[model samples]
Target: MLLPFFQEDLVEAGCDEAGRGCLAGPVFAAAVILPKDFYHPLLNDSKQITEEQRNELRPVIEQRSLAFAVAQLDHKQIDKLNILKASFKAMHLAVKKLQAQPGLLLIDGNRFSPFKRVPHKCIVGGDGKYASIAAASVLAKTYRDDFMKELHNKYPRYNWAQNKGYATKEHQAALDKYGPCRYHRKTFRLDYSQPRLVTMTPSVNSLSLNSEVAVSAE
Candidate 1:
């Protein structure tokens, strides 16, 4: 029962980000401009949906939306700007990739870094209240999950495929054993007292994914 548009006459892109709270992997954001008529009974906040439901809705949103783009800011950048600014930069990047310019931006959170000349309205839980924002939430979550799954392949011990880089007990246990990998945000307090576990650094080749630079779901 999300609202179709913030304004009936203007093109509006809903914005949302995922993985801002994770200890590893990139923070992903998405901008979606849906037609005024867009509707689906299953559409809602990404967190409200199951994995299968998110995956199922992803293609439907993409196919139906007027324009949609997903982007990410990696662990390196997150460490540089802090999670809040990084999340905003990721959302800005996603909006930059949109094929059609939006007259207004519907942001899911209470705060956002303004994007260019575009006006924005911040809704604390807009993802559950607006169609385009909910759609953006779905794309952001699913894309970040896929990226984390790929990273899991390279570092199986972290169990990223299962934990999706969250600070789960198993993930904390792995950090307690092997230390942080290149994929981990060093800024995060991992709470390991062993110097040996803290000494290891990721090799040049270990920073494989260019997720820190830019990621796009086109």
Candidate 2:
């Protein structure tokens, strides 16, 4: 059972982000401000719910919430700033897009960068603890997943539709076979302690800068 709102006296918005751990695709965030009386038996953390349930809740949330907005930080930005900063940036962008100003923000995670001029509360697993935050989670996850499904058509090798750009074994296999696609983050260690395929030789430490220079000098 989730709490309806933080307090009846203050206007509040819930904040959450999705795809923070994906190897590809954008990180999406959502902010939802629901009425004080908002209630739904099915509402909960997005990860704990099925895709069909999330789809069912999305329209209801959008139609019933006082105000709601979703935003995304693309793959390039995610690589430039790193995942942590990119997640916070997406959340802040969503909050900025809200039609109504909220006095307080209840964020799903245990850490959050405060939105400008608005006070915030960081609740660990707030998505399951608060109705508004749960609603935000549903919106963020569903939207991000839909976006990844669309990207699957452009690059079918990675199987974005199945893994949704996560660091799965099949994804790593694809990376090993074809090298990384344009969406792959250069800064991230693609070979994260995973053994290379038996047929592929590992060149992770074969090249030296001075050796290359000496070869060029020859």
Candidate 3:
């Protein structure tokens, strides 16, 4: 069960970002100030929920929240500033767009770039524990997913509609075939330290191991 607010005494906005680990597309963030009494059984980390669930929740969150806003930083920005700073910038932009000015921020990660003079607290996996953060996570993930799906039409080889721009083997295979698109982060190392996004041959056994290893490493 997710709680409504991090603190009862102060106005608080929950913040989260999506697509931070993707090799392509924009990193999106959301800030949501929900009523202290808000409750929803379906709410959890965006990653734990399905697309239909997130789509269903998005409208409800927008209509019911005290205030909410979503923002994104594109691949060029992520490549230029690096994913961490770009994610922070997206969060900052989301917070700035909120209709309600929160007295405090509850960010859903272990690290955060402070937003203005507002105080903040970072809680790892906070989205699964807090209502506002979960809502923000849902919004950010759904919005970014929608963007990727749109991009997929223009670049069908990446299969972004299915993989959502993550460095999946199929996506890497596409990279091997067609090379990195303009949407890919050129600065990100496809092999973790190569400083280039290039095709890597996967051994038959490694093909099965890749998903497990990637998830664990992430």
Best by TM-score: 1
lDDT (10s digit) by residue, model 3, range 46-79: 9999899999999888888989888888777888
TM-score, candidate 1, is 0.91
RMSD of each: 2.8, 12.1, 9.7
lDDT pick, better of 1 and 3:
1
| CA error at residue 148 for candidate 3, angstroms | 0.3
Q: Write the per-residue lDDT of candidate 2 for residues 64-107, one digit (tens) a residue.
A: 99999888877778888999998898888888888888999999
Per-residue alpha-carbon lDDT of model 1 for 180-207, expressed as tens digits?
7777887988755443534344332333
Q: In model 2, which runs have C-alpha deviations exceeding 4 angstroms?
A: 192-218
On the 0 to 100 scale, the lDDT of residue 146 in model 2 is 82
Candidate 3, which ten residues in sequence have the lowest lDDT sum? Answer: 209-218
